[model samples]
Structure formats: structure tokens, C-alpha cells
Target: MRFFEATHKYPFDWETVSLASFRKYPNDKTPHVQHVEVLNQEIDPETGVLKTERLIMVKQNAPRLMMKLLGGSDSSYVLEYSEVDPRDKTLTMHSTNLTFSNLLTVGEKIVYKPDPEDTKNSTLFAQSAKLSADGVLSRFSSYIEETCLKRFHDNALVGKLGLEQVLHKILAEKRQERGGAGNMAA
Candidate 1:
């Protein structure tokens, strides 16, 4: 088993960033993420927290050795769960792969919170993941884990860029709406 952790700062408020995170799929930077299905979504009336579950299909670029272990399959399904607490200004998420878990299981967790020093314009993002390999691939566990972790680390940067793109698009739309409304008033 191996663990990875990373932190990033975004130049956007927590609320905006949270919304952008939900809309991050179907972006150009992450072509590997083919499809996303929202399995469930609801708000906890008592706690006022939003909860959601989604299934994501990914076309992973597995290494040659890993592909052989997975019977030549390059696609996998991941189950993602997330909770948003507006009162706390925080969003937390967890995801794990459901297919080929025995050969390689990767579980990730992320937290997005308001940056204390710059709460109005900045957000803090922290992420951690665990990668484990077993079963017939146990012999190559070390190599597999190393490769998978490296891939994940690189993907993290791409994910951040994707989020930034989504956020920019949303903000631009809002600006256009306001500008159009003002023009009509004039």
C-alpha cells in the first residue's frame, strides 16, 4: 500500500469553487473521463448539507504490464461520493474504483475549504490517496503502485487546470448576464 497527498490554492471563493467542482466533468483537459452518471443527490434537511453519489467511466491508460493483468481492459468504473456543507464553507469527496479492484485499488479523498487569510477570494484544496495491489498481481505490486501513483500525481495538475477552466467559464457567463441586464436598463 502507498499513500499520496497534495495541496493547492485556487484564486476563487469557496462557494464558486464548490460549484465549479461539480461541473468539472466533460472538460477538454480530462478526456480520460468519458462519462458521469449521478446516482443520487439530496440535501439533509436537518444538517443542511448536500450529499451526492456519482458513477464515472474512465478510459485509463494503463501500462502494458498492468493491461495484461487486467485482461486487456482499459476502462474502469469509479464510485464517487461527496458532501457539501454550506454552513461550514467546505466540500469533501471520496472516490474508489469498482472494476479490477483486486488487481489495483485506488481510493482518493479531497477537501475544499475557504482560505482563512483570503476567504473572500481564495480557497484551499487538499487531497490524499491510497493505492494497493494484490491477488495475481501481488508479485508486481511495488512496480504497479509506483506507476499508478506517478500517474495520479501528474493527473492532479490536470484536474486543477480543468477546474480552473470550468470556473472561468462560469464567471464569464455571470458577467455577461449582468452586462446584458445593464444594457437593457440603459
Candidate 2:
């Protein structure tokens, strides 16, 4: 098994960051993410946290050899569960690949919260993943994990850019709304 983790600071508050995350997909930077379907969504009665589950379809590029070894398809499905705690001002999500489980498994966790250093204006983004291979391909597990780990890292950079793109849009819309409201009041 192999592990990967990283953190970033978004120049926005936790609320904005969390909202951007929901709209992060369908952006140009991560075209590999083709579809996202919400399986269920609800609010916890006691905690008041929003709970959600989603099914994601992704098509990522991989080495030809690896692709052929893993059924020659670049598309895979992932199941993700997430929680949004308004009281704590945090959003956490965990996901795992559902396809090719017998050959490999990719489990990922991500979190967005107020930055301890700059709580008001910045948000902290953190993510980690575990990669493992099994079945008759155990021998090549290291290679598979290493290759996928590299791909994962590559995707991570673009993922951040993609989220930022969405965040910028959200901020822009908010500014426009405020401007329009101010004009009306004038």
C-alpha cells in the first residue's frame, strides 16, 4: 500500500471554500470527472450537519499497459460520503473507487475548514489517499501504486486550480449581487 497527502490554503473563508467544492466539478481543469449524481442528501437532526452521498463517474488517463491490465477502460466509478457542519464551519468528505476493487483500491479523504492562521479570510484544504493492489496482480502492486500515485499527484494540482476557478466565479457573482442591490437602494 502507498499513501499520499497534501494541503493548500484558499484565499477565501470556509463558507466560500465549502460552496466551491460542491461546484468544483464540471470545470475545465478536471475534465476527467465526467458526472456526479447525488445518491442521497439530508440533515442530521441532532447535530444539524448536512450529510450527502454521491456517485461519481470518472475517466482518467493511464499507461497503456496499466489500462490493458485493468480491463482496458479509463472510466471508473466512485462512491463518496460527505458531511457539512455549519456549526463547526467544516466540510469533510471520504471516497473510494468502486470499480476494479479486486485489482486495486483507492481510498481518499478531503477536508475544508477555516485556516488556523487566518481564520476569517482563508480556508485550509487538505487531502489524502491510500493506494493498494491485490489479487493475482499483487506482484505489480508497487508499480501500479507508484504509477497511480504519480497520476493522483498530477491530478491534485489541477484539482486545486479547478476549485479556485469555481471559487472566483462564486465571488464574482456575489459581488455583482451586492452591486445590484446597492444600486437599487440608491
lDDT for model 1 comes to 0.92
- How many steric overlaps are in each model, in order? 0, 0
**Would you list the C-alpha lDDT of every candidate in the order shown?**
0.92, 0.91
Each prediction's TM-score versus the true structure: 0.95, 0.95
Per-residue lDDT over 1-186 for candidate 1, one digit per residue giving the tens place of the 0 to 100 score:
889999999999999999999999999998889999999999999999999999999998888866764576788899999999989999999999998887789999999999999999999999999998864456678888888899999888899899999999989988999999999999
Q: Pairing residues by index, what is the TM-score of model 2? A: 0.95
In the predicted model 2, the residue pairs found to clash are none
- The runs of at least 3 residues in candidate 1 whose Cα sits more than 4 Å from the true structure, single-residue gaps closed, are 136-138
Worst 10 residues of 2 by lDDT: 132-141
